[model samples]
Target: MRRGAGIGAIRNREMVQAKYKEKGAEMAETQMATLSRQLAQLRTSLESFAAKHGTKIKNDPEFRGQFQAMCSSIGVDPIAYSRGCWSEALGLGEFYYHLGVRIIEVCMTNQKRTGGILPLNELVAQLNATKSSYASEISTDDVQRSIKKLRCLGTGFMLIHLAGGRTLVQSVPGEMSMDKTSVLGLAETHSGQTTMSLCCQEFGWSEDRARTALNQLVQEGMSWVDDADPTGERVYWFPSLFQAVRSSG
Candidate 1:
């Protein structure tokens, strides 16, 4: 009715929009400042907690786990601090560094047999065996955390999740083809032995495809050829599973 919107009205609307944008920016800045203060407080609190319980954190795995969880909840990484107060209070930097070294040593020591793919349980057992009886026991959580930190080295220190709730650590950096990994799954489920026929039947793959996958793994030294089968077919056994299969048998 008032000649639709006049130029003056449009100018007024623009001014209102500009004001809202300014306010929004101010509010965002305020929120960010508040968050920064909160984070500082959280870090201070964690530091105090660590300083008070430094001994327990060093000697008690459970206490250390709880402390770590608290730090993780706030996006804090004690291990990253590597030096200064946090490291001194938590002992995280030195402890995990040493643990990471031990883990890699174990993996390297058994690399020939495992092809750098070792089961998590075996790794833990060998590691603890190397530790003094007076030393605190290392848990899987500890190994996993240490490995996570070791990933920066780019050596492919990663945990592989496979079928049947089995976790394997891949210490050597290598590519795992889909077909080969699938065949490994079959091996894991069948007492660590998978043959050409089994792979073909399980994955509905062609004979050539199955053979290629099995052969690839064998070439990688991850699989051993068991040619003594009564059926005359070569059984590809996973070295990582030999101990388990043998113990079970």
Candidate 2:
């Protein structure tokens, strides 16, 4: 009888525990539902805000940057999609989408000269010169946002950071060697042209070292040989930078 009683107590305890477990699960589910609803409401409000201020954000670079910051704070990407949720919410999807297409075109046309990398400022200047209809209002922020959307195409569009808080657009697929990167950085500092003497004087490199690096870049089509330089010194120019300089001149 004692054994039977103990078994009954065990069963009773299990039943009680099961009841408590069910109650806990119910409470958790209720909490989760409440949180989900709150999040949904917050998202609705944010969408409304984006729709209302879409025009200001699209037209003014400063305002657009601030809006982007706010979206980021909420873990949102205002320009992530070319259509659907973000497009309907912000109404600026088409603008960035079209800009991204143009960016791809520009990058492809100059790929041989730039070796798939070009400074952000140079890109903006070229885009403006080539597409004058919206040039006056275009800004780096707008271009960056547009480029961010381009990543979805898996075309390997990326932004690279340089030594001086400068950024460049890299539209090609390969990792650049350190020597090549350094050579390009040096070229940027000297108006896109660098000679063996300049590299040796500026970076304390040997003549052979500078020449080897420059030749590699030339072979890879990242730079152009200016053997016909007026000074008779072999000058190598990073084409993207040289293009910008030529445009301004």
Residue range 1-249, candidate 2, lDDT tens digits: 999999999999999999999999999999999988977687677677777876677677788788888777767776653445457645566777777888888888879778787889878877878875753366898889788777666778877766756778888865566777777777777787888888888878898998888888787677888889889999987888767667767
Question: Candidate 1 — which residues are off by over 4 angstroms?
Answer: 1-5
Alpha-carbon local distance difference test for all models? 0.84, 0.78
- Tens-digit per-residue lDDT, 54-167, candidate 1: 888888877788888999999998888765568777777889989999998999998898877888888888888999788788888888889988888786798877767777
Candidate 2: C-alpha lDDT: 0.78
Q: After superposition, how far is residue 159 of candidate 2 from its true place, in Å?
A: 2.2
RMSD of 2: 5.7
The candidate maximizing lDDT is 1
Q: At residue 207, give the lDDT of candidate 1.
A: 98
Q: Which segments of candidate 2 are over 4 A away from where they belong? A: 1-42, 81-86, 112-115, 129-136, 196-213, 227-234, 246-249
Model 1's TM-score against the true structure: 0.90
User: Lowest-scoring 10 consecutive residues by lDDT in candidate 1?
Assistant: 81-90
- Check candidate 1 and list the clashing pairs: none
